[model samples]
Target: MERKALFFLDECRTVISTSIKKVLAKVGSKPVMRVNIGFSSIYVILAINAWTGEVVVSLAKRPNSESVKYFLRYFKRRVGSGRVYMVMDNYSPHKTKGTLEVCRRKGIHPVFTPPYSPELNMAEAVFKSLKNYMSNKIFYTIEDVKNCIKQFFKENKYRFNLNAITYLGLDKIEV
Candidate 1:
């Protein structure tokens, strides 16, 4: 029997976007800085089940082989028994030997998306929707952003019910 597992794995960074209040200035609104040099971004490493809409999220300072290993280990523990195929873009970290070894130990098969083809990954659309949802709000700190992301997953994790799309000829997308 074939493995009944498929997940889209990727990392995302949420940066501060200027609020409408700054755009519609009344000529003396303290001139909101066009670029806030001190603001930091929150990094998110996530895996989403395209079929069921389940999401696993981790907050990180940066995305690298270590984080990928962490995610794979966590994922393995969460779903104890299954053969899994993780689809992701060709980020340098995902290709690292350390990350590959983690996947191997966790019984996960890594499927690489085509080069320069982020649109081919299902996680890309999910990230786009996440960005659109957060675009209007201004976050003061990275922790604040992390909280918002946690809240989003808490609310939407069970609400996904969509058909998976296939882009490449690989036998990766099957119900």
Candidate 2:
């Protein structure tokens, strides 16, 4: 599973957007660039099923223990009928009492990646795509970001290429 954070702005503002080519102007003419001032950051948690590459996402106002717990409940429901060997990063919220309790009840045994090793959590790759997709893009409101994200998740449903997860191998994840 992977988790990421995104900020959204209510107003659109960009003095100079992304440009593919350099301005061929006098040396004294420097271009000024600007982007909309972001207002709130939405904490998003993403979980992917390795076998099917199915992803589920949850958004919250804060990235705290309560939110993690909420996401865990969502994950448990998504996981359906079995125990899960959920690989995760060592985020503090992952170790919260509420989250642990949910895991215990839901039969989700979270295996933490070794400290300082963010790469071990495969969700980073998915989020990287999300970032690139949103980079330099303008959104008029938070709903715009939400709608875009919804579309992204929909189009990419079960679409993650999991060749990097060779150790476990494909079709070996579901229990």
Candidate 3:
């Protein structure tokens, strides 16, 4: 049998600035946090290897079909030639004809999670970890957020155990 590469795919939007409603501080001293009222944000499209925990990330201005296609191309290039099975959510852009076409051209098979079942996608855990890593931190600009994301992944490339998190028993399957 031909080798198959399995990946969990997802996208998330990171805002440039976030406001924290609560914080731990000394008594009688109010904690001040810089918050950007502007809605400037960037979308991150990410894919993680189900067996190896390898990751591919892309920053996009918008979370649309075009961005999905672009990420698919980028993923293909990074992963090289292989039979890829990408498990993703049922986002509208993920099901668009253009995105499907790109997946077909790149030899990527999309396996979507059941409707409204984001928990089934292991990528959600990665995103949650990323959010926690960035929590209580201030980002001055979209670039700052982008740089932070890159640094986070770079410093913690093996932070996640895909086999354990996904409960997919990836290690038991022959690649």
Candidate that scores best on lDDT? 3
**Which residue pairs clash in candidate 2?**
none
lDDT tens readout by residue for model 2, 113-163: 778876555566667676666666566666777766667777777357653
lDDT, candidate 1, equals: 0.74
Better of 1 and 3 by TM-score: 3
Q: Candidate 2, residue 27: CA error in Å?
A: 17
Best by TM-score: 3
Candidate 1: tens digits of C-alpha lDDT, residues 1-175: 6436898889998765433332455766565444333357777888877667677778778787887889889988876777898988899999999999888888999999889987667676667767766655667777767777777777786345443644233457566
lDDT against the true structure, per candidate, is: 0.74, 0.62, 0.83
Sorted by lDDT (best first), the order is 3, 1, 2
- What does candidate 3's lDDT look like per residue over 23-92, in tens digits? 7899999788777765888887999887677789899999999999999999999999977999988899
Question: By the lDDT metric, which is better: model 1 or model 3?
Answer: 3
The residue pairs found clashing in candidate 3 are none
Measured against the true structure, the TM-scores of the candidates, in listed sequence, are 0.79, 0.73, 0.85
Give the higher-TM-score candidate: 2 or 3: 3
**Model 1, TM vs. native:** 0.79
In model 1, pairs of residues that clash are none
